[model samples]
Target: MKKVLIVGAHGATAQIVTARLLAETDDQLVLYLRQSRRLAQYADNARVTLVDGDVSDIEKLTAAMAGVDVVYSNIGGVDLGTQTKHLLTAMQQAHQTRLIFMSALGAHHEVPGKFGDWNEQAIHDFLPGFREAAQLLATSKLDYTEVRPAWLTNTDEIDYETTTLADGFKGTEVSRASVADFMIKVIADPSLYRRESIGLDKPGTDGDQPSWL
Candidate 1:
């Protein structure tokens, strides 16, 4: 069984993935997040280990990387670039190479038409760090899959479409559950989508912007 390290395990999507892993696989989990107590329900679970720390803490991150086979990052913020850098450093030092990261759809400006323009104007502030993180991963030697999810929704269903970096992104919104499902797939099968970027969106939900807006 793969020992998976889920950074930012406190987040919504991460939590979904964590539950799915426990119910579906025999994998061991190391759930790392700042407020570890928030996920106290899993504290007694034999398959789960809670780690209270930030990804920026290289020392703790590297220490937690012990015996980890795959690292799935579900955190994003203004300091994403710095966090990504630290994660890469820790992984390298620990001799870990596989990573599954959640990036933005516009990180590479791969979205098309007016929707793309609207997206750029909407979340412009968050793009730089995501873009920078993407570039850093592109240059790194690790086997990483950058998931660029479209506008997010709280929907419980897992319905989505995917596009590559070379193709234009599709749809306007994708459920967090969908993204979580895809990440679980990668964690279960590391060879799937190795060293590529994937754009995730709900099929037929295309528009000038997300439906919620």
Candidate 2:
């Protein structure tokens, strides 16, 4: 079975991914988070091994990288760029090549509508870090798939559509559960998407795409 490491595994989206992974795969699971308290909810899950630490800390991340076959990073903040850089460095040193990262739409380019406007603002405020992070991942030797979802909702539905760098999807919004499902899919089939960023949203929606574009 594949051994997988999930960074930011305690977040809402990450929690779904964690549950699905345990239920669906025999893969050994490792969860890395900044706070040990956040992982308390998962203490009883036999499939999950927890590591409490910061993803941006090289030494800590490197230690977590050991014995891990794939790294699924859900870690995100205003300083996404720096955190991504640190992850890339740790993966390089560990020689772990499979990676799946969560990013928002309109990260590098703009979406088409009002939601797009919001996304653009987020990018303006956060893209420097996100762009740099993407650059670091792109330049790395690791096989990667970056999943960018539009506005996130709490719906548990799995209906969604995925596009790769296409335009005009300005009002699309995807449920966080759907995003988690997609992440799990990428982890299972790394060959399906590699070194590419993809856009995700609900299958049918209206008006100025979701904020992520």
| Per-model TM against the reference | 0.98, 0.90
Model 1, runs deviating above 4 Å? none
CA-lDDT, candidates in order: 0.93, 0.81
RMSD of each: 0.8, 2.5
Model 2, which residues run further than 4 Å from truth? Answer: 166-170, 209-213
Model 2: per-residue Cα lDDT over 1-213, one tens digit each: 788999988789988988888788898888998886777876777777888889767888888889987899998888898888888888888878889988877766746657677667755777677677777877778798988887789986997888877554534688999899888888888787888888888876655544334
Task: Choose the strongest candidate by lDDT.
Answer: 1
Q: Per-residue CA lDDT of candidate 1, range 114-194, in tens? A: 999999888889999999999999999999999999999999899998899888899999999999999999999999998
Kindly give the number of clashing pairs for every candidate: 0, 9
